[model samples]
Target chain A: MDTTQLLKGVLDLAVLAVVADEDGYGYDVVRRLRAAGIEEVGDASVYGTLRRLYSSGALTSYVVPSDEGPHRKYYGINAQGRAMLGAQRKDWDEFAGTMARLLGTEGGA
Target chain B: MSIVDDAIAQDVRTYAAQVRAALADLGPEHVDDLTDGLEANLADALADDRRAHRGTLADEFGAPADYAAELRAAAGLAPGSGGQRTGGAVDRALRQLVGSVRDIEGTTLARLRATRWFPGVEDLLVALRPAWWVLRGWALAHLLLQMVGAEQGAFWLPSSSGGWVLLLLAVVASAQWGRGEWRTGPRWGRVLRFASGVLALAAAILLLTLPQAHRDDVARAQGWGDRPVEDGVVVAGERAFNLFVYDADGRPVEGAQVFDQAGRPVTTEPYGGDRWRQQEYWPDGAGDPLFHVGVPGPNGETRWNVFPLHSVPGWAWADSGAPLDVTDEDVRGEVLAPSWPFAAAAAVVPWRTGPEATLPAPAGASTPGATPSAEAVPPSDAPPATDGSAVPEPEPAVP
Candidate 1:
């Protein structure tokens, strides 16, 4: 798959994981994603995904008004989102271990 | 100077606007930076394309839908199904509808804004800012004079027309103020200045023509009835009475009545006319009376009048059985014969030129069946004249 497509599939997991640690506004999420080496992530896409996830009951949002500009909506993962993250992590570990074994690497196994 | 460059710039602007609209659902915090970056990139791309003498902007930038898709992807949302999106047709139709509605609304707004007084007095202030201090002083003085009721005082004085003169002065001042181009210095401006001057003059004239009223005044005046009376005679058959009357201004009067010889009014109320009431009446009523009469004018002119009923099918004029002592003079003066279809169909028997002509018809002579010779010809072979100019030749000068 293209890096963009691969990146898209993991974005939800990344967002939940980031907000899993601390709730963040759209810009904060974008900054964290960029810092984490996801250079292809766009500010708009992160916000849209955050809203979608929140609407799908994985995340909840709260408004924090700023004197500098408009109010900011912050997102944090809910119980269902945390459970989804745990399942994704487990699936990733299993896949990585299987790939290591197929590659005949002790570290992978 | 380059068409390509201009087109590219326009495309950039248009694309930017579209992007703005599409991303409006996204909160400003989320999309503002991305949208700004996109606009900058789009502009640069268009500029670069123009420099390279590339193909059309549409070809260069790709299809708008594809661009929107790319933007949506970059924004990190799930990509829409590349497969046939349900409601795609409906969505396209709705977008077109919204676009057309927006275009119409925009045009209407532009037209309305182009009218005077839009952008308003602030624009006037900006344009006149150079002479602001002097104009302000003058305005203050003018208002002070007005506050003391100078206009009313001038009206009561011997020089009663001073108010008009003052108005003319104000108009001249306004024209002069509009004449000064201000920022560009006092040079002859374009035709717009002249137009403004003309408008000011028109406003002055309108003000002068307005009736001045006093709040203290309580009395008022009114006019009484001055309607005219017209008379006519219809000899049965179908007839159409077209009443013509004008007001003092020679305007057509509306809503006049036609009365039968028995003093019975036979016309639809609410007739229309400029000066006198005009109406088309049919003699469909019973007991064919003598002459049909219309109300007389204030000038005592015969108010009600009728003409010989035309013989045309479906054509009926207001009528009365009253025997009119109509000589060639009466027919020549007011009541002309009905034209065409009516003339060809009605049996018009001219009364004999003698004492019998002046005498009332014998009893029962007004009976309908007694006048069979006067029956309007049904399907007469009268060819409708072509030029409408061929006069009927005199009947061989009867010996």
Candidate 2:
């Protein structure tokens, strides 16, 4: 199966986790995700997720001027986003354990 | 910015605009929310793409249209939702129809691709697309000319200079449109699709009618159709059914074989008129007859070329509905001939010499004069041409 298919279900959580670490502009967040090995993450998908999170009040946005190009819009995780991310992380751990157990690949189950 | 950076910046702006245009059906707030920082995002991405020596903006991000679709999906927005509130019921229905038709087309294409030889067929169809574009343009021009009553039956060539210009412009425009040189909004895109469907139907109709129209043109050029065919001899624009030939002594001749100067037999079948069959003839008081029948030749061929053709009173055969046999002795009766218009026509004497042409005189007159004397009139006391005693005996069979 394509990894991109796997990425879609967790893209919102991934975006929230990335912003929760530190404030980053759109491209900055995408670069961090790629460096963290989620290389198949699409640029538009990350941008859209950021916009959706900001609109839903889970993320806050602010403009940061740059001399190189247009002003960059940066996103940061708020309290709502951190709470959501904590719950999602716990859910992910449980799901990963269940999958590993089912596939008989966990170290000690 | 440096010149190269400026060019990159321009590219970023153009790409951002394309993405925005793709999302044009969304409400203003929705579109603004989606595309607020698109240019800055695109600029940073393109710079990295350039540094990495990757493909162009489209290669890095896919087409702007596809990118917009992904954005809409990822943002949890339904496709075409934002534009629904602005459209009327009919517009929405039409949009649904277009979407359904597109879905069906995609499904059909997918099914066809599964067949072994369909790929080759599809390739052939793709190769013929340009030809179809040209033909549809020509068909549109043909329809326009036909509406204005200026068509002259040629498929490839228009009749007038104005038509030629129009055809050229339409073909160029159609080819450009096929090549996707012009950008259209979502609504205009649907309208263009509808127009193309209508043009396809018109092209099919023109294909069927072109051959028939060509045949009609050929018939008109050769002057053969549209008039009833006239057979046999025509005198003063009226068909002469049977010839009435009179001897110099005013006796009506029967069974005279007439011919033209070229010795071609002048067959007097009189296929042009039905009035002769409906006319009443006296038959010289030999009782009225049911119908008339022409006498057959010795070889049993009805001799149409025979003058004052010998006709007899006849009845139809009970079994076949054909005229009663004239050879039968019991059925043979008095020959029914039409009454002659003159008893005895006046005779004329030929003049030997004249500076100016002088008219012939009556045979009894001494001088050749133009004026008619009492003797020049036809004699009323002479025997009628239709008299029963004047009937001649049948000549020896010539077959």
Q: Which numbered prediction scores highest in DockQ against the true structure? A: 2
- Runs in model 2 with CA error above 4 Å? A1-109, B1-85, B111-121, B152-162, B212-229, B234-399
Instruction: Give the per-residue lDDT digits (tens) of candidate 2, residues B259-364.
Output: 5654455655543113244323344444643233455554554435555544444333333445445556554444445444444445545455873554334452
Model 1 agreement with the true structure over B48-71: per-residue lDDT tens digits: 322333566456555555555555
Evaluate residue B51 in candidate 2 and report its C-alpha lDDT on the 0 to 100 scale: 33
Error of 2 at B341 (Å): 14
Q: Poorest 10 consecutive residues of model 2 chain B by lDDT?
A: B373-382
True contacts kept of each: 0.10, 0.42
Best by TM-score: 2
**Candidate 1 backbone clash number:** 57
TM-score of chain A of 2: 0.92
Best by the lDDT measure: 2
